[model samples]
Target chain A: MSLDYLTALIAAVLFAAAPLILAALGETISERAGVINLSLDGTVLFAAMVAFAAARATDNPWLGLAAGGLAGAGIAAVLGVFGLLLGASELAVGFVLTLFCRELAYFMGHGQARQPGPDLGALNLPFLSDLPLFGPAIFRQSPVVLLSLVAVGLVWFFLMRTRAGLVVRAVGEAPAAAVARGLAVTRTQFLCCLAGGALGGLAGGLYSLSVKPGWGHPQGCEGAGWIALAIVIFGGWKPVRVALGALFFAAIQVAGIALQDVLPGLSGTLFQIAPFPVMILTLLVVNLRRSAAFREAARRVPLLGRLVPRTAGGAPGAIVGALDKGF
Target chain B: MTGRTSSLARAGFSLALALCVTLAIVAAAGAPPLTTLAVMLDGGLGSGQAVLRTLSALVPLLLCGAALCVTFAANLWNIGVEGQITLGAVCCVWFLRDLGLAGLVPPFLAVPGALAASMVGGAAWALLSGVLRTHGRVHEIFSGLGLNFVAMGVSLWLILGPWKRPGMASMSGTEPLPAALWLPALGGRPMSLWGLILAVAAFVLVAWVLNRTFFGLTLSAVRQNAMAAERLGLRPKRRMLAAMALGGALAGLAGGVLVAGLYHRLIPSISGNYGYTAIMAVLLASGSLRFLPLACLFFAVLTVGSIQLPLALSLDSSLAGVVQGVLVLTLFAARRLWPAGNTGSTGGTRNRGSAA
Candidate 1:
């Protein structure tokens, strides 16, 4: 590929990764707080529909985004109310909400389907857009892309550097200890779920208002949430790593599109679903590193020991423990 | 209140709430609620043909619901059941076309061969997720979801590329199988008595195994406390895998029935969201075999009935899903409001497991 084309493709990948970055980071916050907000896939679709409809009605993309964020937060609130306060299973509630919100979005947004709406376009940074490569790919993009980049740094800083982040981590680690520390455990988790949900919703809004653009049934962002969820595991739940994971996934997606032309004989649907199996394989590899036999083999061989990175991170202790307890 | 009475109260309350909310939604959407109901009734069960359609739809719902009961009993979320059904259908088509065709297999044996292939396909698919859950340290939900997409991709590839209909590549699905390979249907109707018998028999057999068999008790033991079950010499992981395989086989049967009895071809949406819809029904049933069949029938009605909403009321057919979701959510809310007492409760009383 030519340099200009390569630069453009790089920029496009960055743009495509924007929504996933937001959603994954959002999920990272929630999971870090020991809540699995599995309603993400439905939340994205619902948010996309709401964002598109609101933007069309008000003719303001920002309002559309805010509306989408609210839509996401609302779903999270339902999950929290059922899963946390009422002591229902998070997986059940989240799974039900995912399917429910999807059909509800389609049902309610039927009228708004295929309607034209205002889209958020790229804001060209005068000097940056003219830069050799990095400028166009990084700076000369929509605000949502910039927001996603900012989100990585911001989430990392919030989780690692802040006192509140410490409290969140502490609560996630041990709910009883958090209670002893006078940290409102449920409240903290609820707030984190809401925040994560808002981010997921914004990601959806970005899809409709910027990334994919326009509203329709079978919205292009249907399976994006599940992929984001997988990316979280692939990234080991670190903000920066998760952002990188999103970018990597986006690159795969872009490559799929590019490969469609090169291998015209293959079906397009095959290209579309290529990343799902890749995600599963990555999850298997990531998890396999922690398995007993893998660790044993790694220990027996000096070279293998060096090759296998020390298992620094797995699921949060409380999430794993609680889920295992089936409570 | 006794657990049984409280359960009945919750069910009734949830039903009332679901009805109120659905009617309100229909009225708000500017369609007369009563008219919508009547229209859906007419569409789903107004005549012999419509009843046949509903019954055909019921076969998958019952089978998928039965599949879910097994997995849910073991506390495994087999969300990949949707993909299992798709794989099953693909396998059925593959068997019928490749082996059963060109006089390789007799017509009488072809249908049975396709069914067996579908069962194996589904069981293998579920086992993959089960293995991932037990050994790979991957959560079944994520693995299941990922496999679901991959299964869709595989089916799509088969339909559009290798299995495309003669002279045309289309999203409409693959070529229809020969008549001899099809499940024997009621005279001139699409509904098959054999499919109905298989679905109902499978459900009843599952219910018996779950309620009476030692294997079912062990599964319950594992679900209740896997650590304790393990200490008691029960192999929790193996039981979980067994549950998943059994569930996958039944789900695969549903797929086979879809191809042989209903559609006679592998379509893009062959599963028709039945797996997820079955999940909702199973949730409402809340581990009780008694309510599960009713839940499946209720959902089957809503699904088949909602088909004519666009034509009759200019409303989206997805209203069926909205209603089902509301009903389940209301049940959850009701259970929260009125927690069942310690006595006279079955598996439904547990707040420890994943679902209602």
Candidate 2:
């Protein structure tokens, strides 16, 4: 690939990475707290429609964002009540939430399907946007990109340093212990589950307002939520690493789209299934070695040094808390 | 939950609970409480045909659902029942493509061919995940989920590309099968006798397989505690794979019956979320063999009722999907309200509805 292609690829990757980064980061926190919100995709779809409708109805981008957050939180709250308080299986509960939210969203967004909204405009930096290959491509991207990066940093810092983060992790590590130690397991689970759903929803909103920028059709939201969940697994539950996981996926998707222009034969009907194949492939690859082999493989990568945790010197523990205890 | 509560009372309580929750939601929507109940009941059960059609709808659902219970009992999550059914129908269409073949062979051959292909499709699709979980040490849920997307893509590709009916422009779908390939209506007897008998047989077989045989006992043990069972020299992976394969076959059979018995041709929407619909039934029937059919019929009624709610009230018909979701979630919650046996953790509940 030439420099121009590389530039285009990088730019596309950054843009594509935004939604996944936001979503995966959200999932990491939720899963870390021992709650797997399987409703991510539905949350995204519902929020996207609501956000688009609000933008169209009120003509304010901020209101649309708020509407998206509210709709997402509302669905999340329902999940929270059922899974946390009522003690339903989180995965099953989230799955049901997705169906419910998607249907409700379709109903709420019925007439708005053909309509458009006030799109989220791009944020063009000053002199930075004028530079050669990198200038216009990276510097002139949407604000969602920068916001997601900042969000990742914030999440990482909180998870690593904050007492609240420790509590959340503790809940996942041992809910019974947490409860025994005076922590309100129910309340923590409830809040964390809803918050996860809400964030996933907000990310869905960003997709609509910034990426697609209008009412979506059926299957409108697509599998971004699943991708986010995949990224969380791929990243092994770290904010910075998860962001990179998002970026890795973003790069592949951009390449897949761009390859359509370069080599038409490569972009056949089968390429539509690329994400599934790639996801399955990555999952297999990630699980290939025992913990020791994974550590050895990570040790050789220089730039990825920071991405691998010190614990990576030992066995890697991924897919943590995917299931609830005593289920 | 208590044995003190009569079986009749427990059943009544659940139905009433469902109705009360549903009516409360309707009331919140500003509809008159009694009027909504009447609407739901009329739409669901007022007419004889309506009730029969609902039962008919439950036919395929029960087929795939009973099949799901078999696999779920062994802790396998088979998410490709929809595609398997499509494959079965596609196989029948392919078999009867040359109209002369339909005239040449009896419907018996056609029926087995359709059902066999679906079982193969379901088994192969599930086997991929089962292998990954067993050998690759990957989790079944993610692999199964990934398979769902792959199946959809393959289905879309087949219908839209190679299998595209000639000269059809609007959308891609299989042409209708030749009539000889259709499952006969039981010596010209009506009332879906063939389908009804098959469904009943499926229910009985699943109950027997999960309860009667040594294999069934072993599989249940595997589901409850793989590690402990493994120490007893029972191969968990093998059992799990067998369970998934069995699940796929059952789901595929449902798909087969649907095509040969009802639709007579496979359209792209063959499964139409019915696999997930089975999930709802499975969730409602959690841990109970006898209650499975009851839950299935109740699910059918709720589904049919929701479809009619819009005509009965000014509510949108899509309320059916929401109600279905709520039913699963509510039943799951109710299950948790009083946790029962510590049978096992890996007792994978069929989201037959993913339906969960």
Candidate 3:
């Protein structure tokens, strides 16, 4: 491919990755706080529709983004109240809400289907746009794309550097210990879930107002939430890694489209279906490090024996640790 | 509050809450809430035809619900029932074409053969997820979700590719199966009497297996404590796989019924969210086999009735899904608030199984 063609592909990948990054990061935060918000797919769909409708009505993209974020937080609040406050099963509530929100979106958004709405366009930075390959690929993008990048850095710094970040990790890792240390476990979790939800809503806005643009029946965002959930696991709940996971997923999607010309017989349907299996495989590999049998098998291999670590690491302690309880 | 009384009160309150919320939504949409609901009821059950349509919808819901009961009792979330149904339909269509039995074989023989193919297809698809859970340490929920996507892709490929119509492929679907292969309809009703009979038989079989068999006891034991079950000489993994296979087979039968009896064509939307809606029905049943039929009918009404919403209120029929979703959420909340004395821990364990 020509340099220009490659750069354009890279840029397209970035734009596509934006929503995934936002949603996955939000999930990372929520899961790290010892809560799994499985309603992400529905939340994103509802938010996208709401965002599009809001933008169409107000003629303001920023308002649409805010509306999307609020919608997400509102849905997440349902999880917070029921799962966290009422001590209901988070998974069951989330699963129900996911289906509910999806249907609700379809019902309310029927009128908005296929209607044109305000969308974010590329904004070239004065200095950065002048740079060669990186400029066009990274700098010459919509504000949402830039914000998504900044979000990666911000989430990382918040989780790794801030005191509140410590509290978040502490609650996720050892809620009882955090409780004993005087941290209000429930409050922290509730706040984290809300924050995570807001991000998810913004991700939805990114989809309707920028990435995919326009709403239609079935909306085409059905699997994005589940992919984001898988990405959180694939990234080991780390912000930077989660961002990379999003980029990697987006790259696969872009590459699939790009390869259609080179390999006509491969079929677009095959390409479309590729990510789910790939994500499932990645999930297995990530979890394998913790499985004793996998570790034993790795030790028997000549090269892998030397490289494989004796101890598994990186999973958010509370989220995966709860698995041991079989709950 | 006494447990039973509290539970009753909570149920009443939640129902009211759901009604209010739904009405508020209807009003916001500029539709008369009471009239809209009346139309929905009329559409779902007003005439004999409407009742028949609802009964037809109940076939898949009941089958899928019964299927889920098998796996859920064993504490496996076979979320891929949606995908399994698709595969079943695909298999049914393929059987009809490849067997070349449209005219050669008798209707009874061809139909049974096609149904068997669907069961095998669904079982095989579900077994893949079961294997992943047992061996690969992957959660069935995620694996099932992934497999669902793969199943959709496969069906799409079949419709748009090799199975495409003679002239050109379209989203409409593959050509209809020959008339001889179609299931016999019931007295000019939209649904087949055979499909209803099959669903009833499946439900009875599931109830019997769960309540009367040693296998059912083993499944419960495994669900409660795999380690304990292992020590007691019961193979938890094997039981799990069996439960999943049984579940998949039933769901596949639902798919087969949809194709042979209802749609008679393998369209992409054939499943119609039946697999997912069945999850809600199963959950609402709360492990009671007797309640399964009622739960299925209730949801069937919501879905079948919602079809009138777009016509009467200018609303999307998907509002039915919204109601179902809210109902499940409300049930979860009520379960927490009331704490049913005997079933409390079962609810707790189910939560943990999915959460982890």
Candidate 4:
């Protein structure tokens, strides 16, 4: 393949990765603080519908993005109350909440099926505009991509350098330790979960206002939330790494689509099944106790590296500090 | 939730509030106002045929709900009842497809064989999830969920592939089953004797296992306090799998009966998300096996009311899903106020306690 092929590949990867990037980043924050919200799937559908409706009403794509994020956060806030304060199990509450939110979106979005949302126009960077096929695909998308990168930086800084982020991590790693050290465990968890919710909402906005705009069906959002969840596990609870995992997942997804073009003989349904099997396989092989090579590779694979660190002494500050530098 | 009194009044209040909220939604959908709800009540409970239809729907829901109760009691969250139902339907269809054998075996013999196949299929399907949870360290909730999707995929492939009736989709199913394999109608009634017989037998068996047997006691112990149960030599893994397997088998049997007694051939939409709906029923009843029959009646009424909207007001049929969602949310909210009575042994009080 030529450099042009490389350009096309990167562009496709970015296009595919954007939603996963936003969703997984949100989930990373949520899970990092020891809260697992399975509601991302439902949150995505509702937010997509909300953003679509908002964009149609105002004809302002930016408002749609805001609406989607708010919609996503609205569901997340419900989860926060039950999980943080009511002391409900995160798994059950999150799963059930997701089901309710998805149904709510389906019920409400019934009428808006015909009217497509306003699409956010493309943004082309001045210097990067001339980089062949990759330039337009990579640089000339909506501002969501740029914002995702910025959010990654901000989240990385917040989680590692900031005192509040430290408290969030403390709560996740050991709630008892955070409580002993004067951290309000519930409050930190609430903050992380809600932030994750907002980002999840933003991911929905990116879909409705950018990719597949105005596409309204019963389940048009279709499995993106589960993909986001998979990305988190793939990234192992780190923002930048989650982004990389998003890219990897995006690549597999894009490949499934791209393969249909080259090999029409192979059933696309079978190809579509490939990623899930790959995911199941990857997960099966993960978390080994005594494999040194697996441990080393896992620690160096950027997002996956977050799972197993390579520090010899295992010092807390030093390890987190090393993670901080890596990001 | 434990050590707190005052749950009865709270649960009662929440249920009423939820029902009222549902009434309001129906009104907004341009159905007749709150007063017209009486018409719905009359329609659901008034006419003999309407009542019979509601009972027909109730029969399967009752069986499924009872089956669900067992799993929920053990905290096992078996959401794949729909698939088990589908698989059971397939097994029944399998036996019926053999035209020569169908003539040889009498209806009584064939019916039991079909029921047995269904129960076994359902049990094995559920047992796979149980095995994964017990040995593979995977969470049962997600694994069960994944199996639900897998089951759907298999169902679609079967219907669209091998089981695809020549005019099925055009007519929407296989050629209707021959009368020989059909579930026998009750004495001088339109309802199936099998429906009543199977439902009653199941209720008796579940109640006996849950309330009478040592295994029943052990299962509750496993649910209430897994570690303490283990300390007392009750293997939680085995208890949970048994509970789920039992739940799965009954759900599957319900699926078979639904096919033989009602639809007779497998269609893709046979599930109607009933397995998931059973979750609402199980939760609403607080997994009390005794209350499941009543919960099924309430759900049957709820289903009739929701179904009336499409013909009566052009409302989408998915209104039932939203209503069930509302029911589940209310149930949890009710627990917040009332403190789940049976759940006293659960929660932070027993950090070692678990649901399946």
Leading candidate by DockQ:
3
Give me the runs in candidate 1 sitting further than 4 Å from their true place.
Answer: A321-327, B27-31, B341-356
Query: What DockQ would you assign to candidate 2?
Result: 0.38
Best by lDDT: 1
Q: What is the lDDT of residue A159 in candidate 2?
A: 80
lDDT of 2 by residue, A60-177 (tens): 8778877887777778788777666665666667766776777666655656766756877888999998888877666788777777778888889888889988887777666666
User: Judged by lDDT relative to the true structure, which candidate is superior, 1 or 4?
Assistant: 1
Binned by DockQ into CAPRI classes (incorrect, acceptable, medium, high), candidate 4 is incorrect
Q: Ten residues in a row with the worst lDDT in model 4 chain A?
A: A318-327
Model 4: per-residue lDDT, tens digit, A1-327?
887787778777787678779888898888777777788988888898888888888889899889999988888998888766766556556766776767666656766766745888788898786878767666777666667777889989998899888887877766666677787877877888899998998888888777667745554455678768766765657778779888887799789888889988554445544554455334334423113665677666867665553433111221121111100
Q: What are the per-residue Cα lDDT tens digits for candidate 1 across B244-265?
A: 9999999998999999888888
Task: Give every candidate's TM-score on chain A.
Answer: 0.96, 0.85, 0.95, 0.85
Error of 1 at B32 (Å): 3.9
DockQ of each: 0.48, 0.38, 0.54, 0.19
lDDT of 3 by residue, A212-287 (tens): 8989887877789999999998887889999999999999988898899899986698888888999889888777
Model 4 iRMS: 10.6
Clash counts per candidate, in order, are 0, 6, 1, 5
Cα lDDT, all candidates? 0.86, 0.69, 0.85, 0.70
Query: CA shift at A223, candidate 4, in angstroms?
Result: 3.7
Q: For model 1, which pairs clash?
A: none
Docking class of 3: medium
